[model samples]
Target: MFDYLGGNFPTIDRRSKKQMKDVEMVAQLLLFLEEGVRAYSQEYLDKAFSDRDISWDAKEEVEKEFCNTVKAIKEILDLSQDINLSKTRLKNQADFYSLFGAIAELNRENEKLTITRDIGVRINNFLKLVGDTELKNQSKDSLTDYQRNALEYYEAVKFSFTDAGTRKTRIRIMKSVIRGNIN
Candidate 1:
């Protein structure tokens, strides 16, 4: 974006010599930012779209108020700084600490889900390996039906994921992630 906007890129459309004006480009970029935010966070999108066509002044306020980025963060989320001070329900954005807290909460939840998904994949691979071993040994028929059924039953119980044992494993895995001891 910097290179293109700075006129450093050699590539340009041959069909049209005219490029978008600054205002048009800003509006398009803001719209894209809103769309991208809406995809991930409905709460942020609701706050962003609450105002009936937010003015440039509101955008300027966000740009000036927030840290880390210039207009990029402002484009994604339009916040009223005054409203934030008022403790209003229409506060455009949560404080940085609050937002980070929410992200940390989400990270834990996602970690649990990721661990469960990984375990599910491993269970599948284990079943395949066991089956292949039996086939290679030509010992598939040696095991009684009950033994084979027990192996299948173990798979079924583990794969249920909602079962007590699986739930415990999920908790353990989540804790491990928090401790930075993923294994």
Candidate 2:
């Protein structure tokens, strides 16, 4: 895991090759983060729908929230500052620290985005399972058969991120669910 405890975050002051390497690592990390969010969102959906006790309206709300959250995150990333290793700062620790903080935050956002995406995935999965199980047990024709299940299960499970927040609860999704349980 990347260490953000000592505050040695990803910054532009690092060596050219090292900075490039960090950028690549950050990109790959983002990919995993993105995939994880999508996966977990479906997982949440699956749980909510399969349980039968939860209302469809509630599931819909989760889905809506997931969608909106994803949109907002994407917008933030698009509008956020880009990491520029080209601007070398050899003597300025403050500049390096600021750059490091920016990189760290960007990376953190990727992780959060992944989690929110997974929440949507979970909700979706719950819906699918509910529909499948209901049909199987009731002898009723399903809207979607087991063989014909169309919901694509996004398989994106990734490790979580951890950090200390001053007087704030560290709500990391991969470690635990930030939201309330479906039941």
Candidate 3:
């Protein structure tokens, strides 16, 4: 959506249809990457243990790179440029692929963090359920605040990512959002 451009660029309706389509494709790709980063960041907040131990600076650096890449792509689409539409399309596609490669690397880094956090959460939950269950049952004391919070967060994250139906629904929503069909 052009709204994401933060008013940095003018309206694109005056461009040729082919150029418009190329710009739209670039916009959709950028939107998808933005959403992916946001979703992963939220999951990180919810599920991460020892968050201080993780280096989150890499995420910030990648985000800056993404912004710069988007800006460059937009500049290429500027109407004042004398380049032909076909040449612009080729350049845009090249830039898109470059951005895609950067996105892939960022995703790999995020996946590592997610996998580590998931393992830690699962282990903590398992220990509490098995080893602490008897103690909890024998005593009148309810689950500790920490235990309750961790379990709730773990369940939420697990259900969000593990269910086939949920995954399909999320995919549908993502597609619509990227296509600018959803607000």
Give all candidates' CA lDDT scores: 0.32, 0.31, 0.37
User: For each candidate, what TM-score against the reference?
Assistant: 0.20, 0.23, 0.23
Ranking by TM-score: 2, 3, 1
Q: Which stretches of candidate 2 lie over 4 Å from their true place?
A: 1-49, 52-55, 84-168, 172-183
Model 1 RMSD in angstroms: 18.9
Stretches of candidate 3 off by over 4 Å are: 1-55, 79-95, 99-183
Model 1 segments more than 4 A misplaced = 1-7, 14-25, 34-54, 61-183
Name the lDDT of candidate 3: 0.37
> Global CA lDDT of candidate 2, please?
0.31
> Could you give candidate 1's per-residue lDDT for residues 56-149 as a string of tens digits?
4456533332222222222212232322211321011112112212223334356322222333233233334324435344454775543353
Worst 10 residues of 2 by lDDT: 150-159
Superposed Cα deviation of residue 163, candidate 2 (Å): 13
- Name the candidate, 2 or 3, with the larger lDDT value: 3
Worst 10 residues of 1 by lDDT: 88-97
lDDT by residue for model 2 (1-183), tens: 123212233333368536464444333333223323222233443463366354444445444443444344333223422422212220122222222232234345554433344433433343344335434454334434421221111011111211122101112211122132331
Q: Could you tell me which 10 consecutive residues in candidate 3 have the lowest summed lDDT?
A: 112-121
